[model samples]
Target: MNRLSRVSIAAFALAAGAALTGCVVAPVGPYYGEPVVTAPPPPQVEAVPVAPYPGWLWIGGYWTWQANRHVWVGGHWAAPRPGWRYVPHRWDPGPRGWREAPGRWERR
Candidate 1:
């Protein structure tokens, strides 16, 4: 077989193996929803307390938009999810205005 044919066969084999494995890779990005009229206040400096239980993770405090204003949510300890990671709530300044994203657990 020619070099081009060998390369094409190798690529096909790799693709087939990946398909059989059912593995998929995709780019994850923040979801931009409606813009808030005002920006959120700066995050508070939190002194994370010790975990009440072993293997627990600290979820930091963040500013949340509520009732047309910013509200401070205290930090707390949460039991770790087996195959997921915690996403802290945050606000991002977009072209239109500040956008708020709520905390969530996403697959690792």
Candidate 2:
């Protein structure tokens, strides 16, 4: 291939790779910042069962916006990781709408 063609191909490949892997990129700030005018409150969660094993933590359920409405995702047990704590997702009202803060593990 000519020099120009090779450069174009390289640039195209880089852009494609970035686009494909875009979902894996972490948000830059506290939340995604996309908001809705309003969102329903989280559903009532069932009692948490006994931990399957020691050192497991119960992550609570939370409401997620879907199909232009709020959806409930149930809670579950998660194995505790060394030097990390699980932060649960939450919804907070914003000027434009309800901002969703996704859950993540933070270093202790």
Candidate 3:
């Protein structure tokens, strides 16, 4: 291969390796945020798609607070926790407002 062709091939290999490192093999815990005053609207209906891998489950989406407003985050399939169950993210009503509890995997 010419010098230019060799350089292009090397760059392509590096990009492919970087992309493969980001595979989601398991569910990750969510980040917490400040509470919002406005209550979230009803959850939107979503059609669960096929799992990327076997044993994955559809984790339904929930309302999230951003910029003091409720936003709809779409749902997706997640790799199941072998010895644990997922606690869904939710916004609980409080005296100050709605407090957001991040989703987490808990031992069964």
Candidate 4:
């Protein structure tokens, strides 16, 4: 009986881990913000180092908050390293309004 209980407990833990692996954690706060009337300055582009020899791509800016969740500043575009391409940040409008997606990199 004890061995059976231990097996059940292990199986339950494994199942729970597998279930959580597929679960998505929603952002803690509200998703959308009020649209701004005036557009901000063009995103600043900086020359970030490619670091290693192969070099990883540079992606566009992101909106990150300082202090609290009240404000989100935009990210900037950067020049690509030797073997990388810029992936632009895209915003999707759905029932929840704007959904900001991060940039990705693909081998050239």
Candidate 5:
């Protein structure tokens, strides 16, 4: 092939490969609408002890999916971030299954 034809073919192949890979890798977070049928067990109430240090916030415990079952993760103290509040993780029931919303820091 001529130089121009070879370059054009290479560029087209690269673009096509990127497009296909993007579709396969696009969903990075928890898979929604996955069939679970049964809801995860209720979260266990963990006693929030006194903060170990000043400006520490108590993040509550939550149930996490593991080995097709719900597992309890204990709560712990986290250093407070300026102008931000920590939101605790939670599992919400949906028609198909429970969706886990991970905890994150949000600006006040």
Candidate 6:
């Protein structure tokens, strides 16, 4: 086979594999079916009281669940060990539900 034909065949194989792998979803972009927005659960209150921590900040709470398909992990408040800053949590949406992504801190 010529190089061009071989390349075309390889590309076709890759596209077929991607389809079989369930990587392609029906209609790209966020789902637009009436927006099933469930309010996120409030952050869990920290059980451990502060002794003398100054930089500790509330990371906020999150909603979590357990099942065979996927698990929902809620957000939490992170106590700054010493130098790290607290990054507030943010939300992202999907077909199943919303996801809370963890925040990061930058050094000053």
TM-scores for all predictions: 0.65, 0.66, 0.65, 0.34, 0.63, 0.33
Residue 34 local lDDT, model 5:
51
Query: Candidate 3: which pairs clash?
Result: none
lDDT of 2 by residue, 6-96 (tens): 9999999999999898577654533365877777684676799999999899998878777767778889999889999898887778777
lDDT of every model, 2 decimals: 0.84, 0.81, 0.83, 0.53, 0.78, 0.55
Q: What lDDT score goes with residue 15 in model 4? A: 96
**Model 4 spans with C-alpha error above 4 angstroms:** 1-10, 21-24, 28-38, 54-56, 60-87, 90-108
- Candidate 6: 10-residue stretch with minimal lDDT: 63-72
Decide which is better by lDDT, 3 or 6. 3
Global lDDT of model 3: 0.83
Candidate 6 residues 1-108, lDDT tens each? 899999999999999998899665654433223233564555555455553456556554444332212234544446666665666555567787665454568775
Candidate 1 residue-wise lDDT, 1-108, digit = tens: 999999999999999998889777867643446687688877899988878999999999887766566789999999999999998888879988888888899999
* Top candidate, metric lDDT: 1
For candidate 1, the 10 contiguous residues with the lowest summed lDDT are 25-34
Better of 4 and 5 by TM-score: 5
lDDT of 4 by residue, 1-104 (tens): 69999999999999999989988986675333433233333455655645444433445455532233323344433445566555665555556344555466
The whole-model C-alpha lDDT of candidate 4 against the native structure comes to: 0.53
Ten residues in a row with the worst lDDT in model 5?
Answer: 24-33
RMSD values, in order shown: 10.9, 6.7, 8.2, 6.9, 6.3, 9.7
Tell how far residue 39 is off in model 3, in angstroms. 0.5
Check candidate 5 and list the clashing pairs.
Answer: none
